[model samples]
Each structure stands twice: as structure tokens, then as C-alpha cells.
Target: MLIEGFIDTVRPSRNYSEDSVGRESVHPDQLDQLVRQLRIQRNDDARCEVKACTSDLGSAVWDSVSAFANTSGGMLLLGLDQESGFAPAPGFNLDRVRDQFVDGIGDGGSPGRLVKPPSYAIERGEVDGAPVLLVEVAENDLGSKPCYVRAKGVQGGSFKRVDDKDIKLSASEIFEMQVALTSQDTDRRPVSEAEIDDLDDALVEALLDRRKGSKALRGAKGRAEQLSRLNVTTKDGIVRLAGLLVVGRYPQQFLPRLLIDVTVHPANEKSAPGEPVRFIDREQCEGPLAEAIDQAVSVTARNLRTYSTVEGTARVDHLEIPREVLREAIANAAVHREYHQLFQGQPVTVDVYPNRVVVTNPGGLWGGKTLESLDDGISRCRNQTLMQLLQSVPVADTAGVTVEGQGGGIKMMIHEMEAHALDRPRFRISPDQVVVELRRHGAEIPALRAWLGGLSTDPLSDYDDAALLVAKREGKVGVTDLRDLLRLDSDDIRQLLSDLSNRGLLRFIGGESYELWSDEPRLRTSDEQVIAALSAESPLDIHELSAAVGKSPNTLRPILRRLIGDGHVTPTAPATSRSRKYLRTR
Candidate 1:
């Protein structure tokens, strides 16, 4: 067999030269030299024998490979044998040896003999006229790990490489190896019966509706059918992790610590004196995943405040917080939480403040991911089953949301907040928890209040506040011009402008598409001077005065009538048009 061929390649040499074995060339001379050097030291680190042509030595070869892989990885020479006398060693047959080795490695029935990384390559060379196969083993950085070797009539033993020889690993090494293999699966045991029936029907229905477009969900006719289609059932017809989280009647019954705690504290409490920091409100929401999310959002919305905007002559209340965005963030926390990572009594928490809302889950991010890569579409879900179930729920639309997986909840939340000129949510990951904070409408910076104080006194609407900040820094802006600057929709821009205009804080320049705004004091004085200048230049008509003063015709008519009634201006007929005009009654 090829094992014999690989063994034959191990020829004894005259000197114990390590440099000769380390050479890059796989030439016949170099292989011979390497083989000779290995024979001198009995293959002590300088070289090792690999039997690629024999089935009898399979276990031995695997043990040797495992030793090298667990310690410092190295090369094993196959298709060669140890030289007995050293009288110009003879070459071994190479035919069929490579195929035999490949078949043995690929055998599925073999226990504790899985390929490493699977993409590693092997090569063949020659030594002492004998065919030599080189099996390069790369070290596993997963620690000084111990790997198992399969034996015929007995259970496999843990092996490691130590002091240039393959030896049985110690008890401590074996224990560590067992721990590494079982840590991830230890927390994923089957769910209990008490929690099985706790699945929420509403959440299950929502999940089924979302799965209507999925190819995997095509066979399911209803909610119960879809649950089975998603493999969310155990052998006893009990719900699994997916069902327990999405539809369970009492989700906290299974996961007692799954509920989120939301607390609102006074703003000054962060650095308050001896007085105890008072909480505005505190609520604990429980139930199926969807219900908990709904409760959390409703509570948050009830506590939030909406600012009124003066649109034209009327004031309208616009939603200060984006309900859809807040809901998505809460859902993401519920779905991505590490249910198995909790220890004794701690649970997930969501803290709502006047300026920001923080959603924190128990457990750090999975899969070596970093904050920079959070928005890069790379995700490692700790609760994949939970994620899959949540993805099937239609609580919110995540289209254009860039978070990984079909559940773009995080991405959607960020996008919505940004679209409204709010700061992007801040994410923090600790060894025990992951927290995401979403800023409110005007809480982008602490200096926002100071900045507003520097601006005019007219109560600035949210959009107007954003526009004034942009205009102050950018210099001179129009209605259409401030839209891009403030990241507001066209309607929002129009409403903001109308609000400013009604407060006598801003005025338009004639009937131009682009209108300029001046401070209220400056504009009021300008209006008075413009009327006087027009009256002195000529007996101007009301239309001429309205056009020159940049006021709406209807608005100008009321103002002109008031001025005529007050004896500040008099009515007259212009020569060009038969219509009445206004002249200063100085």
C-alpha cells in the first residue's frame, strides 16, 4: 500500500543536519538529504514519516498528524521507509499510493479523524530513488489543543506534539479539549413542556405572514403548518427555541430573564447631589417576543412628546419620535439577544431618557465582529433560530436597511433616525452585554441648546431648529435651499417656513421661487422703509407696493387697508392702471 511507499522514503543519513531538512527545494538530492538527516535523529523534528500507501498504519499516521497539528505544525514525508543499513538505500514503488492515502483521509466512517480547515494542499517528491509524499500540516491557533486518534478495537486517545515526539496529552489538556468542544452546545438543550405552550398566537401569525414570500415557507398552509415547516418542533410535538421565542404563550416562563426593563431618570440625576435620583417611570414588559416589543414601543411613545408647528395660519403636531424606527430597534434587541448566556437573575433592559433610548441585551456580540463592521453587512448571530423566526415576522419593513440577515431591523432603525436628522444610534459591547442607544430628535449634540439660545427668540420647530443651525454655518438660505441642509422632506420644509413666517421672524422677497429670510427686527424696519421709499418715488398702487415689499397679495391687501384706516397711507389711482394704490400720508 502507499503507506509502505511513504515509509520507504524515510532513509537514514550520515549527519544530523537540521538546515538540510529545512531547504525549500523538493529535489531528489534535497529529499535524500532530508531523509538521511531524519534517520540520524530518528525523525526528531528534522523529519517525520508518513505512510501514504498502507491501511494498517492509518491510526498511527493520524496520531502523528494530530500531534503536529496540536503543537507546531510541520511536514510529514510519505511513500518512504527508514533505511536499515545505509548502503545507498533503494527506492519504493509509488503507484497507487497517492490514491490509497486520499481514500483513507476521505473515509466518513472513521471517528475523530476530520480534515482541518479542509483547504490545505499536499504534494509529492522523491528521496533515495523512492517516491516521497509531503503532507504539510498547518498549526491550529485555537490554542495548544489536543486532538483524538482513532483506534481499531479501542476508543481513541488524545495526542499532542512535545519535545520533537508524539505523546499522549496530559489530563488537564484533555479536560480543556472537552470544554472547548462542548461549550457552544451545552446551552442548547431541548426546551421544556411548560414553555412549549407559551408561544404567542399573534406572533406566530405575523411570522407566517412574513414567510409567505419565502421559498422555504411555500409548503406551509397556515401558522401551525409553517411552524412545522421551519423545524421549530421537537420529537414530542413541543415547540423548540424558535417557537418558544416567537409564539410561546408565556415566553418568560421558559426564559424568566427575557423581559426588558425600561427606566426613565431625571436629566439632572446623572450628577445630582445627596438627593436620591428619582425615576420618572419604570415598566417591565413580558409575553411572547412580539407582544413584549409592542408593549415596549407603546410605553415609549406614550412618554414621548410631540412639538407643534405653525403651518400657514394653523399649528399642527408632528410626531417627534419615529414610531416605526423605535419599534425596529426594540425588535432587534429581542431577536438577537443571547438567551443562553444569562447566568442567574440578570435580564435584558431598555432605558429611556429625555434625549436618548438605550436597548441593552445580555451577551457580547458573536463571531469576532467589531463596531466598525456593524454596518458593513457582516453579522454573526448568536441566536440563529431566534433570528430566523423573527425574520418571518412582519412587525416592520426592513427594505433598504443594511443590517445582515433578512432581518434588517438595526439598519432600518439607523436609516430612519438619520433620515430625520437625528444622530446615528451608538452601539456598545461589553463582555456581559450589548447596548444600542438611539438619540431623540434634537439631542444630536449637547451644545444644541446653547446654539439655539444664540439664534432668534421665535420658538423654533424641530425642522426649523435644524434649518437655523445649518443656515448660520452655511450663510444665507431659501425654503428649497434649507431642505437638503436640514435633511427634511419638502412638506416639512414648507411647514417650517410657514411657522417662522407667522411668528414675524422671517419674510419672503417678492414672488420669487427662492426667498431670503432676515431677522425679525431687521425685516420689520426694512418693511417700513420700503413703504416710505415707494410713496416718495411715486403714488404707487397696492399691487406695485405688494410686489416691491415681497408680501403676498392677500396679505398685503389686509396690511394696506389697516395702514389706510390708520391714516399712515392714503388710497389713490395710478396713471398706468385704473386700480387704487397706496401713498404715504406724510
Candidate 2:
């Protein structure tokens, strides 16, 4: 019945024999060879008179149809000159010729004929002024053995595919062909005895809710109407695969593997340890998917810790771990997990930790989707029906959040983490496992420090010491002045400033208008002593400083300016004809 529709879609202009359908255009040279092999009379099935209006058709044409349908269907072009090699020469009455071919094949009484009459269409066209008919045949789903050829007296025969040849089927082979065809019809029978109650109610509710506010179901009228709208129920009122997945009282009744498993472990125990790891609490939950997801989320939330920062005055810590992100990730895993793990006792595993959480589900990146593609929002859901159902239910936060069946959850989770300055979630895949690890913000930084600590011999740089020295002795020093004084670069100086400020050793003040750093303590450095000594006497020009310290003016200018900026020195007078002078800020 389905094949009939396909036939109508692809109308062929002429009827072709099973074997001749896929025959390549008969070449002008090959025509002679073919004629010789068939031992046909010179003009039989051959284009006689390069432009003749009519010619006798060959009986061998039927075999072409059988050949094509048995294999990948092909087309056969007729009315072209085989001897002259595709030279356009219109032949007599193209429609009549096509009708004759169709009638001959459909006659059914022809010797050794078993070809199912193919539906064909006819058209008139000119090939270099020569009439030609195109016959297209479709490959039959009849497996590898429905083919046949003219035999002594038999109507049905057998054939086999050899290297570009159709070898006749043996008697034993013909018997086997009959057996296969008889069983094929029985094998494709529709599933029976399936009922609506076999579907998971939660799953159905979820699916309907997914299309909320759509006129598609007339608001589903009620549970039965909703099931009918989803095409989960058959005309005879039996439940289908889609129905069994959602709102079914017992989905496992029809599909036993549709359940999920959620487990929680204490801080130290994965399995029972020699000494049980004391947990504030621990629980394992399992059931129809919706309940399992809710319980898992609740447990995860209860176990997670809320972190606070010095800027607590800014925002509250209601959710340390994003609830929506976690819910979607968990729901996606359950919906997409492979339900056919034969020996595996569990389908999904949710492990909760004090500082992190891990969800492992069966099956890896499916449908050509890889980790890279997952992050790029390439989604492929292996179970479309189940996915549609899950979509109906409201997401944790809203009624209409759609989970991308294309595996976009990874990107979403990463985005959420980035929002909180948290580490990106890690994804790993093994033979039959897919694992996602969500680490709490700042949890891994300390471990990284400990690891780096063991790998080095030198102590880490102490920027605070440098910042304090510059601040106490130099008072308010320009960044460049501080760098030169400490023999550091701009970057190192900036790092010192930032570290000091973060540790409460220093504070930033002033707007961008006129920024300055001031000392939180009094002077204690040799440089401080030098500046104090010079300033206490009076302000001195670079030349005066060079004379006093017995150094070049170039060398003395830097130290004097730093002192002046640090408030250790004050200008005695503005620029004058002689030289500018400075004094200590007494």
C-alpha cells in the first residue's frame, strides 16, 4: 500500500522488464554484440533504418524490470536507436508503444513471469528527432530473492546477484525465496495489546504542557483527549510508544527499562567505607522519572553550601548552585539515557559531594554529536517520543523552557558557571558512560595552590611586603616611582598594589581625576632616611642634591622627586630664574 503511494510520486513513462530497467544505454557498437549473443533475427529489438517510424520490441525487456526491482531500481529508455547509438530519430506512435509494453507486462499469463505490474506513466519527447520512452522502476523491499527470468514452463523463478550478472536460482533457492516472502509480511505486523495505562502519566503531562497555549490539541480537553492529540492512542484505543512514555501508570509494563536511579553519598563514603563517612545526611531515591528528578534536585540543594563574600552587602546567597541549570542537566540526562543496558543495574547515577556534584548516565554523545558540538548547541535526541513528553512539563523555573534535544545543555551549564565566576563543568566519556562534573566556585583553587606549593623550591613572591615598604616610607608614591624604588616593573608594581588592597594592607582612594597612594605607616627605609635628611635642611635642586650626595644630577633627580611626591619634601618656592627650591614638610 505504501509502495503504491511511492509509485504515484515517481511516474514512469514506459513499462520495463525487471532486468532491462537498469540496463545502460545500448551503445551503437555494443548493439551488434548483444544482437549476436541473443541470436535474434537481424531486425528484432534493433533500430532498423536509422530513422524508422516503427520497430518490433524485444521479449527480453521484461527481465530488465525484474532486475531493477530486485536490486536498486533503475530506468530503461526505449525508442532510441541501439545500432546507431542514441541518435535522435523519432519513432511511430510513442504512446501506443508505451501502452503495448505496459499491457504485455501486466498480462500475468506470460511465460515465466512473476513481476508485480509496476505503475507507470508515459510522455512524448524527441531525442535528435527520434522518439524515446523512459521507464523508471523502483527497488522493491522484497529483499534479495524475488527476481526471475523466462524458464521452460514455470511462472515464478529465482535469480541471484553475481558480479554484474543475474545467475538463475537453483530449485532449492526458489523454495527458500517462497519461504522468505511468506514470513516477511508477518514480521512487520503492528504492535498489539499496547494500552494507554502503560504510558507514564508524568511523561505525558510533561509532553502536553510543552505545547501549552497551542491550538494543536484544543487544550487536550482532558487526559484522554491529550493522549489522543499526541497520537499516543491508536484508533482502536490501544496505547502507542508515545503514550507509554508519558502519563502511563506503569511505563515499565511495556518498556521495562524506562526507570531511573538517583544516589547520594556522604563526604567520604562512595561505597561503605571501613568507617562510615559521617554525613550531615545521605539518601537514595528512585521511581518514575519525574519524582526521581525532583528528589534528586531537593537532595542536591539540601546538601549544597552557600558561600558569602566580603561584599555580602551586595546580594544574598539563596542558591549557591543554580537550580534551573542543575534541573535541566539532570532532566536531560534521564530523558536521553540509553534504556537498553542489559547487564547494568542502573541507568543513571547522581553523586552529590560537599564541594561538587557529578551525574553519570548511560550512553555517550549520540547522533554524530561530539563534546565540541554539544557546547555549540548541536542536539540529537535518540528518543524523540520521550523527549517530546519531557518538554511538556514545566521546567523548574518556568512553564515553557524547552530542553534542546540537540545536547545544548552543556553550553547552558557553562554559561551559568561563568555567570558566577565558577569553573566550567567537565565532561568525560568512556565506552558506555558519560560523566558531567560540576565544581563549586573556588573549590579547586586551594587544591591547585597545594599542588603548586609542592613543585617549587623558592617561596612565592610576597607583594604585600613590597607594598607595605613603599607605602610606609614613601608615603603616597606614583606607580612609576614605586616601581623604580623597588627595582620592579609596572606589572609587578600593579600586582603588589592589587594584592595589598585585597589583603586589607592598602586601600584605593580618589576618583580618576587625581589619584594618589598614601602611606599607612611612618618611614623606616634607607631611602626614607636620605629623603628626610635632605628635606629637613631645605629644598635642593638636582645640582645641589648631586653636590651634597656627591652623585650625578641624573641619579639624584629621581630620589628627590620621589621625596617631594611622598610629602617628605615641600617646594620652598615656585620655578625661578635661578632654580626651584624645596624644604621638608615641617
For each candidate in turn, the TM-score is 0.46, 0.42
- List, in order, the clash count of every candidate structure: 29, 41
Give the Å shift of residue 352 in candidate 2: 1.3
- Candidate lDDT values, in order: 0.57, 0.53
Cα error, candidate 2, residue 490 (Å):
25
Off by over 4 Å in 1: 1-189, 201-214, 217-226, 268-277, 310-316, 341-344, 377-380, 394-415, 418-421, 440-465, 472-516, 519-586
Which candidate ranks first by lDDT, i.e. highest?
A: 1
Q: How well does candidate 1 match the true structure, expressed as C-alpha RMSD?
A: 21.5
Q: Tens digit of lDDT per residue, candidate 2, span 304-359?
A: 66632222235334356677677776877776665433312455667776567788
Q: Provide the lDDT at 434 for model 1.
A: 74
